[model samples]
Target: MSVRSTAFIPAVFKNLTFWVLIAIISGVLVGHFTPETGKGMKVVGDIFISIVKVFIAPIIFLTIVLGIGGMGDLRKVGRIGLKALLYFEVVTTFALGIGVAAAIIIRPGHISRAGLDINDASDYTSKAQQAFDWWEFFKTNITLQALILAIIVGIALNYFSQRERIVATLYKISGFVFKLLKLIMWLAPVGAFGGMAYTVGKFGLQSLLPLGKLMLTMYLTMAIFIFLILGAILRFYKIRIMDLIRYLKPELLIVLGTSSSEPALPNLIHKLERMGCSKPVVGLVVPTGYSFNLDGTSIYLSMSVIFLAQLYDVHLSFTQILTIVGLLMITSKGAAGVTGSGFVILASTMTAIHSIPMEGLGFIIGIDKFMSEARAVTNFMGNAVATIAISKNEGDFVDREHSLNIE
Candidate 1:
């Protein structure tokens, strides 16, 4: 028994999920016990995210170029793009409705805002007052920029006489990039630790207690959406949601610890491909979904608006509520993967409505960091589901035993 137990310990230590989970727990303890040191650890997480981000553009460019160029079918590319956009629109609309519905029913904002920090929201609110420009959003979002350039280059590559040779070379580079990504991923636990520590150290858990109801409401709503709405959709495709969640557990934990989905973007692309989603579908759908198909951000945006309205006792008519949903369908697209973007989008929506006091935002700002983990995880899961759905719809999904093999 002693020999068997000793052998099992090394296997447990080898799992990335186990390490990441331990890091998160350790971070919380540090933040709670030694706040100043935890706050300074923010640089660790930031540096890690910055390092991971370096690969995002090139990976996206190569993957899309290879996916489209290799396929040699512009028509199919157009078909997949159209289907993905349509899927994003339909699913996100439901997400918006669910968020708004949950907020109204629960009325989490119907509480005292005493002692909550409202001043921390100034930067986001100031940005929100600026008119949301679709052109600017596209210009500033590096992921979308990479995606557009890749699509154009991919289409151009198909018409090149020497396309096959160039694609072969690009494939070799792609292999190196993914290999490098595997090595970089070893730091995920460290990054997770820093991110969690910074959040808890800076905000302190006690500061968030007053808004526990809002936190609970948001979490429960997202859980329901994931298991019920997303699960039902996957069921129709004969895919199990639990299976996908289990497969993506490591990535999800990274998102949870980091409180940002961008950390998991590259891994999601690789994992979706490993799950038998065609390269083109994974490349095109995943990046596009980051900007346009933000299920969790949409939910957060809609819910925040309703929570604010209820907080101030502002009565929103059915028509106005519908209008809010319609507006959010556009505004939420601008949130992207940027930190504090959700707040900016929420502020913009509040500004446009002219009813809810923008100051109400201050009430929730302190707790947003804690809630971001939930949002990021949901967003990560949502994008994964989107990729799989589009792949299956295009008849590009292949279920294979080897699909589960990931280094």
Candidate 2:
């Protein structure tokens, strides 16, 4: 609650972020030392992520449709919605460019030594090739075309949602999501333990070394996006962004534990309301933001693609690279901020750019986790910024409370 409270922490000097960092570090350490336990630990993280996931679809639907439908004059949203969407696009595209540039310059993943498992990954080549094989997965995940279908379904549901009979049904569906979230969170402790143990068991501490730059860069960039980009936007509304951050603490922690942002939707809703944002606005902006404003995934898709290309010494003409970037921008939007979303888009990106073989994915498979931290942070910052931007433009900006003001 207070900086003094953070000072009382036994594990680190202070702060919630520090504690989560410690938890992650400890998990990684424990997971690596005992690779035999990695399987079980991985399950913990997976289960935790799954628990939060059940809430995603319903939350997205209710939040967006209600937010929009509740807007009595839809035309009034033109300025807010369009401007907010524009911000998401510009910021996310810049992030992707930064990632690609970073990868090309650093070549962080390419310095494989003689004794390194350059050849061992041969066993993993097929596994890697699968990443670029978008067609095979498109059939299974339903994330591609089905994603648009979900919007259509949401639209249809909203039409019925207006009638009394359908309103009751829609509310019932929302209730189901709440129940699912509860059932899953009940198992979080077990899941957290398992996930952390798995990280420690599998790679131990050694894995962190290779991914150090990526982890640090991602974290630092996330901070910049929040304090600078998001902060500047919030300041325009004369609201303290850190106050918003504080309100969303619960959801943020849940995201950290599971590395999945979807699970935190309900909490985000509750926080936004408490901060004086109208319920309809929170519902509409947040869910739609999940799909359209995934700033983090944009960066990751490009960074990883560039990283992999460099890792394998693949050459890309400027025209070829620009095509990949443009294609990725389309494919990466609306990507869920979950463990596998980056991979999903990567698979699609490779398909679009025939230059890279599907098997090329295996090169960085071992390091995706490190890359994910960066991606998740970006996604989180983007949504938070979008909510504020929309609220300001809609004349719904509320300055109810202040919890932190580091800037």
Candidate 3:
């Protein structure tokens, strides 16, 4: 059956996106007028994100396990994983290059550093001083751990004599998890309100004036990457980028509101499956992409590096720029599943470069929260596109608009 359509009036009021938009506007007003009250609203957002996170591990485990178990092909599973990693590497490299190019052209760091705040960066800097280890990353990243475990369980189940029964049981559990997730999602507007309020309350809108150029550069660069680079990739696969985006509007709104993609992760999987992407492709790609395919974060980190060099009047040679790209190729994978990881990754990269002053990080701290929504949204879109592309590549996709009258 096709998705049911309601009359415009009832649709607008009942729509989650409409409420989220209103919440975001209300949050801005609250934060701008009464900063203390806005700051206090943080718990409302935090609790919502936390409640959503409760489903993440289980959903990842169940979905991936079920997908792979259904596939019953160990070799195909490995191939999809490899292809996904390869796609992530290539696209993120382009994202980094675009970021660096934009920063150089825009020259956002030309403003005086005297007005930039440097005190707030101490926490991220201290965290950056510690080395990044894959083992440590795997240990700390519950998502990665869940992904790996799911693959193993899925592969193991392929050989089980009663695999069909186990899969049937797991499918029922999966249905229950998603139903609960649907109910929990009604709190998204509240979460969005709290998130926006906390951000604006903590860092007032006036703060954007001083670093407006950098903020503009960031948003502009991401827009280019989304429309030009990512758009091309989707188009090449015979998929309309705008169509995919419009279809994902609700999840995108949730991500924009939360400034954290995790809240939308389950929904993305559910929606992609609804769009006729195979369970295996969505399950395998989405969680893996969260860690490896952070298009927005790559752009931000690359631009931040260049922005810092320009801010400090430190000239980066062509070779140094390449080195930054190469370094980020490795470092950006660590961006997911950690709080303030973007800053932490930036700090670590700067420390390794030893040319740009590590203190420059504090300069952008005021507006980082504002940019995070964009980062999360871009990352969310990148993962979705990746899933669809991979699904088509594996001959595993069906266009729901044609088959199920999804439109």
Q: Write out the backbone clash pairs for model 1.
A: 118-362
- 164: Cα error in model 2, Å: 7.6
Q: What digit string (tens of lDDT, one per residue) describes model 2 on residues 290-360?
A: 76688778767887787667756788888877887888777887366677677667766776676766666
Against the reference, the lDDT scores of all candidates come to: 0.87, 0.63, 0.86
In model 3, state the lDDT of residue 173.
Answer: 95
Give lDDT: candidate 1, residue 270. Answer: 84
> Where is model 3 poorest over a 10-residue stretch in terms of lDDT?
398-407
- TM-score each candidate: 0.96, 0.78, 0.94
lDDT of 1 by residue, 1-407 (tens): 69999999999899888999999999999998999999999999888888988888898788888888988899999999899899999999999999999998899988877768777778766776777677877777788788889999999999999999999999999999989998898899999999989988999988888889999999999999999999998999987888888889899999998888887888888889887998888878898888888888888988988888888899999999999999999988877775567877787788889888767777768888888888888888899999999999899998887465554
- Superposed by TM-score, candidate 2 places the C-alpha of residue 229 at a distance from the truth, in angstroms, of 2.7
Root-mean-square deviation per candidate: 1.7, 5.2, 3.1
Candidate 1: where are CA atoms >4 Å away? 1-3, 402-407
In model 2, state the lDDT of residue 387. Answer: 77
Better of 1 and 2 by lDDT: 1
Whose TM-score is greatest here? Answer: 1
Best model per lDDT: 1
lDDT per residue for candidate 3 within 104-146, as digits (tens), equals: 9989999865566767768876776666666877788788888
